[model samples]
Target: MVRAGARFMATGPAQSFLRRYGWRIDRALIKATKGHLSMSMVMPEVLLTHTGAKSGQQRSTPLTYFTDGGRVIVVASNYGGVRHPAWYHNVKANPRVTLTSRGYRGTFLGEEVLGDERDRLFELATQFMPNYAGYQKTTQGRRIPVVAFTEVR
Candidate 1:
């Protein structure tokens, strides 16, 4: 098992600084660390690969995903920032995606949940990490989005 606290200790400073500067330093750290921090702290079960909506380029992001029956749930809080994250926009443009988890990698279909479904999933996710509640409070009016990715084929 990876020590979650240790991973946070490694990236906490950078994350905090970036949060203040209105930049995504976490992405840089994740890329530089090659998923080490995510593996250690977040226990990320899925790495989402989304094609750029306009450019059609491939973009991959490691996210903390949780399995709910047959679907995979991912949060789009972006630490409750004013703007949506790049990955969120990528998924919005292209609903098809790929994911890797538990040494398994495969293609999947993605979609944003709606209404009660989204609320329920958000509640479930908050149970896993209560900090999400604090994250929600950081935003002014935009409600954080929760996206669901389901296996295809």
Candidate 2:
């Protein structure tokens, strides 16, 4: 049932609604629980904080993430939407980021991965949540970005 619902939520109005409100609820839960929870019924989630590109304001986004060799990976699929997520652009403008995950918080430098690296990370992300495949399908010609966040000293 969860898988079926996940497929349904991967596109159309269901996804739009969830995209509008789901992250807000997840962020609240993370704040309340101190990162014990954010993404349930799915892969690991992180609360990523970054400086806005234009506003220079701090922004926080809850995202499902995977890890490779201690580096955090996140996708900019934006539910297969044509436009990228705001956080993606933020990280691009300023790679330094602060993230909270699994009850722990740390700082990192975000970088967009491409070529073979993106393909590999995308595979891992898809395995974590099959819905990402649907996201890629919906985005058409646009290439969804794969970002890696390595810890900052």
Q: How accurate is candidate 2 locally (lDDT)?
A: 0.85
User: Model 1 over residues 1-153: C-alpha lDDT tens digits?
Assistant: 233432452366745764564133434445555434433344454567799988899987766667888998998988768777788999999999987665566788888999999999999887776656767887787798999998899
- Over 72-132, each residue of candidate 2 has an lDDT whose tens digit, in order, gives 9999989888989999999999999999988899999999999998999999888777888
Clashes of 2: 0
lDDT of each: 0.72, 0.85
Residue 135 displacement (Å), model 2: 1.0
User: How many residue pairs collide in each prediction?
Assistant: 0, 0
Per-prediction TM-score? 0.77, 0.90
